[model samples]
Target: MTNNVVIPSRCWCGKGILTYVSKTEENPYRRFFRCEIGLKKKKEQHLFKWVDEALLDEIQRMHE
Candidate 1:
């Protein structure tokens, strides 16, 4: 069974590429990524967090 996974993607800010930082167990160990550029800007710059599934549900509902 594969344990570690690498997600190749860019940040929302279009600043720098993001990499998997850590994993959480809120819902079966979800992977989290963060923007390197945004991290250097501020501690709470809103770039170092995982995309929550709840947000996706809300977005899908909005389009329907």
Candidate 2:
């Protein structure tokens, strides 16, 4: 069984609003997030990626 986790709509930089960009097909299956307001500033652009289920589960099992 699998579940779709809803990524929160908050930026890591404490910005209130964030936007979804795209998902990567890499081993960790990155789901990208971009800060809406931070993008305006060339240096302050904030983007992050959340790993998908498979990689997360693997890591969890390793620690067990």
Candidate 3:
């Protein structure tokens, strides 16, 4: 038996894990999470979320 509790930090692509990276431009110094393969130049659904924004959305949902 395996416990498959999907972590909130994982990418939708089951294969790739989300990683944190600091933004270099735009919102410089801000951190975000994305699928490790997001760096690849391919047309696929990848996870790219700002840490702050994601947290806010979750909080909002909780309050609702």
Candidate 4:
């Protein structure tokens, strides 16, 4: 069997999983990722990434 390293999509904090949220007003229907612990600490800097941006980055990496 071939060995393959697996990578996680969650935050490095190990507190919660990545959550998908849809922006409905300013950026209607745009999807983004956030950590589940956002509700507990409003000021905490958690994972916040845009789905489109992440996809674009991945595509770029594949071509490199």
* TM-score against truth, every candidate: 0.35, 0.35, 0.65, 0.70
Runs in model 2 lying further than 4 Å from the true structure: 1-9, 22-31, 45-47, 50-64
lDDT of the candidates, in the order given: 0.52, 0.53, 0.64, 0.63
Tell me the lDDT of model 3 at 36.
78
lDDT of 3 by residue, 1-64 (tens): 2222223556667656655668676687786776777668458777776778766776666676
Candidate order (lDDT)? 3, 4, 2, 1
> Model 2, residue 12: what's the lDDT?
63
- Error (Å) of candidate 2 at residue 39 is 1.7
- Per-residue CA lDDT of model 1 for 1-64, tens digit only, reads 2222223255556666564545445535654456777667775463454546434544665676
lDDT measured at residue 2 in model 3 versus the true structure, 0 to 100: 22
Top-lDDT candidate index: 3
Give the count of colliding residue pairs in each prediction.
0, 0, 0, 0
Tens-digit lDDT track for model 2 on 1-64?
2342334466667776554445444534344445666667758756443435435755666676
Worst 10 residues of 4 by lDDT: 1-10
Supply the TM-score for candidate 3: 0.65
Winner of 2 and 3 under TM-score? 3
